[model samples]
Target: MKGINITSITLYSTVAFSSLFRSCAFQVVPTGCGGSRQPSTPSTSTGIGIGTGIEPAPTNSNTIHNNHVMSDDSFGSRRQLITSLVPSAIVTATGVSILLSPQLSFAEDVQVDPVIVDPVIVAPTGEIKKLFNEGRALEQQGNIQASQRIFAKVTKLAPRFIYGWAYLGNSQVALGSLDPAENSYTKAVNLCVESRKEEEKLGIPRCNDLYLLYLNRGSLRLNNGMAMAMAKEALLDLEAADSLRAKPDAVILQNLARAREVNGLYAASDRDYTVAISMTSNEVSPFWLRAALVKFQLGDTMGSFDLIRRVENRFSEAPEVRAALAAMLYAKGDQDIDTARKKFLEIPDRQRLKYRNDEFLLNTISWPPRMIDNIKALSDAVGDAGRVEI
Candidate 1:
């Protein structure tokens, strides 16, 4: 690397970096009145060391700015070549410096043609970060549509950015755009895996966002339907989330349990539900309710009712408690549907004013498909007779 022109790249028989990295080749555009300046034969391979303050090759009034650097090649930058060469490395330089990465073994005494490459410098994330922040702020202010537009721009700018794709999926889910949301989440999942793979190569631990990405996608697939294949897929995603977790998380376990149950893995579902029940603190009622349903499916009918009774007695005043437990029991078809109907329908209109819609049962509770169908059936069963009068 000693005394080589700063404008020239050391082309060799051996690659300098890991083969996993894609090359950032610059278009080699020759200059001068002649077609191309013959490059000097590359020196015998040896250790690479960075040097400073060497002047760029002379050109016929060829002024190259920072944005557009040309080295007889359509692109070349002293800084960018260094940046692209070192992955997961921190580089702090005083002035203009050239880099030659270590661990690149060149064939001994093999003379090769030297080529200057215009590195495909990746755009800095500052602008994308700023836009992402703006989008997040809009989301906080409840302007989902505007944030959606901004995140769309973010993804377009940096297509591989994981958080951008994840947040875009979030916005689409909020806007009732299920298909688009699924696609965005799928894209984010793939990018997240790639990011984690790179992180592993750098010897860094896995990121925390990965589990949440799986959780959201799995939940979407679970609540969307109880199709055997989709439930199996949701189970796979939730299990992936579980594996990534450092410890048991109640919400993730709850979703995982549901996915497991839908796939008919009763024992595994029961275990996940039990863990969720133990982990739950603030939302203990929902976890127990799900556990109760799982027990009912596992043939512990009396035990399931006892758990449901415990929730009813504890959270008697909470309408969701009544609605969720009642819908599940009513759907079982063998129980006293009338009593369960009364449990769900008897809430007063004044209280019903706040819990007037399906959002609470569908979203807050996030009942699985079969359970949601049962809830819908319970709603239709009583009709106006069950509808509370103000």
Candidate 2:
């Protein structure tokens, strides 16, 4: 819509990328001073025409460095400004004053007004690139905790970096730290949006980063049970990226399906998931949940039961699946007290009470202690004669 062609592939790519790096704030620490100076304005890099020799402004020394000069409050390189202002008579005739201030000791409470320095844009060095690659590798290998730490360092080193925030959020999600992951995703989206806005203002090529950022944030919200907001956000992102040429990826489709499901749009959600499952090579739990939910909503109890069983067998370790199973068993038990009693008895002592009391079981081990004792005592008194199956 904004003259940037978007496709389904771009949509998925954007979504995936959104989940990876989401910031442009470069990480910098003062060499000797306690607080590192931050740029008041965001940075833009041409990567081609922009000069690379301009160093960052020296915070402590009150030194100002700019490749482009500033005019009328506009920040730019000196050369660019000089070229533009060279034609003006007043600009050429009038001399500007340059001021310098002495440095103060770190411990002393000096009242030196802080200087506002433009950001210094640096190319990603080999070492930083290596760290990023290593972090990605670790993430792929399922070392989420380690990968998250690496990404954190990347963001710290390159605060204005785009990929740094997204990946950090992904690592946090993998570690099951939803709150931090949300924060990271928020930062990523903010950066992506800002970057896109800057690019748009300059009439440059549109970055699909904003599209992906929204999609990833939506997915995170969906999984965390914030479905309504997630769905809305995902819709907005997908729409923005509608013009890209790339085909919609399986992951993006999956996210859309999930968002729809969370929003209670059953038919549409089911269709999306069905398509996603067909596209994906791996067996994902989401597809199972989608189908199971459809069957459940359609009153296909047996179908839902079978699906739940498979989910239990395959992903037994997943707490969500376990909870779902527990819920199903509890519901079934509620419908038929006799059958429920049998099912409850079938469960292990520790888990038996878990079936009876939905949600978190309170003191499972000591539960039914008195009832169990009474039954045992009565059985002992009656012996073989009182062996009743009730």
Candidate 3:
């Protein structure tokens, strides 16, 4: 993303689940911008850094002079290298050309128009398009099995059809096949990258396809051992695509923060959630969640409680948010029987089944344990973290 004017990184990374909030600011990657987009270099080849958020920029492929990093595919290793290279001070570049590698310069000093290439028609004899249409129809009809089958056919018919791969992944997710869904998304991303190399086209569709793929994959990685790293990569990809498209898209950023939160990267998660809230519309859930979690981690019990109250005032009907609040109240040892009864009643009947048949929750609390104790402990953790309580 060199030579590109990132007028507002904040505008693009908005808070999700809240449906409201908005703000904008410029964010500079202080360390460097390398990895995935460019070829790999020696460990010393590039660095990475980031600045505060900003408003949305115009959509274009224009080059901007600024810090850039060597292209690298190994995202985890590349991030470390970039972090080590950027200065602690706020990074600034007006029109300076930063070299990431011998071939790629961060900014060219001279403006060069983006290269546009025609998309290669990879659909096989109309079969790929047919399969894509069938997949969509099946999905709309709630026939996930049939949709996946159709999409699978599309991918086989035209492996390079990016949409085919993206749709296939989406269907796989609906079918609860997370691993296969991830693999499908990965195929789409690979096609996007390969298409760019072959066609010199950086269209919004390709970027969007790649962005969605990363977002879904990161979500799948939320509870896994690689959660932190996968979430970071997904967030980076989301930011890059948002920047390139010059559109405000807070959902990806919000989810990115949640992924970090789930993995216990509290500091990183808090920052992302805060930024997302600042950049979106007036809904307050993200702020409540992140702020409350930070307060809880800091041992400020009341602060977390206040956040839960605020969320309840706004999103009481939201099952996830309510569940979290109930968990929080229980944790604080607030034992008013009437209030507990009311809170318990407030939990959706559908979700309440977990109190009976959920093996994990049952095991965690030592099966058939006192309902009150379960409520308090789970609530506190959920409310503090602004996460859904089971």
Q: What is each predicted model's overall lDDT from 0 to 1? A: 0.51, 0.42, 0.43
The candidate that wins on TM-score is 1
Q: What TM-score would candidate 2 get against the native?
A: 0.47
Least accurate 10 contiguous residues by lDDT in model 3: 31-40
Ranked by lDDT, top first: 1, 3, 2
Candidate 3 on 1-390: residue-level lDDT in tens?
322221112211232322111111111111111101110111112211111111112321111111212121212211111122442343357765554422333433434455443343222234555555666566545666787788788777666566566566655544556578678767766665654445222221212234434444554444222433455564555455445435544545555555545445667656766666565435454335544554555456776677667767876765545545555555556574445445755766555434434443322211112333445455443332343445
Give stretches of model 3 more than 4 Å off. Answer: 1-125, 141-143, 199-208, 223-248, 279-291, 298-303, 314-323, 326-390
Error of 3 at 154 (Å): 1.1
Candidate 3: C-alpha lDDT = 0.43
- TM-scores of all models? 0.53, 0.47, 0.49
Q: What is the C-alpha RMSD of each candidate to the true structure, in Å?
A: 24.3, 18.6, 19.0
The residue pairs found clashing in candidate 1 are 26-118, 75-118
> Model 1, range 25-121, lDDT digits (tens) per residue?
1001111110101111111121111111123323311111111011111232232122223434444575645554654334343444455543211
Span of ten consecutive residues with least summed lDDT in model 1: 19-28
Question: Of the candidates numbered 1 and 2, which has the greater TM-score value?
Answer: 1
Q: For model 2, give the 10-residue run with minimal summed lDDT.
A: 2-11
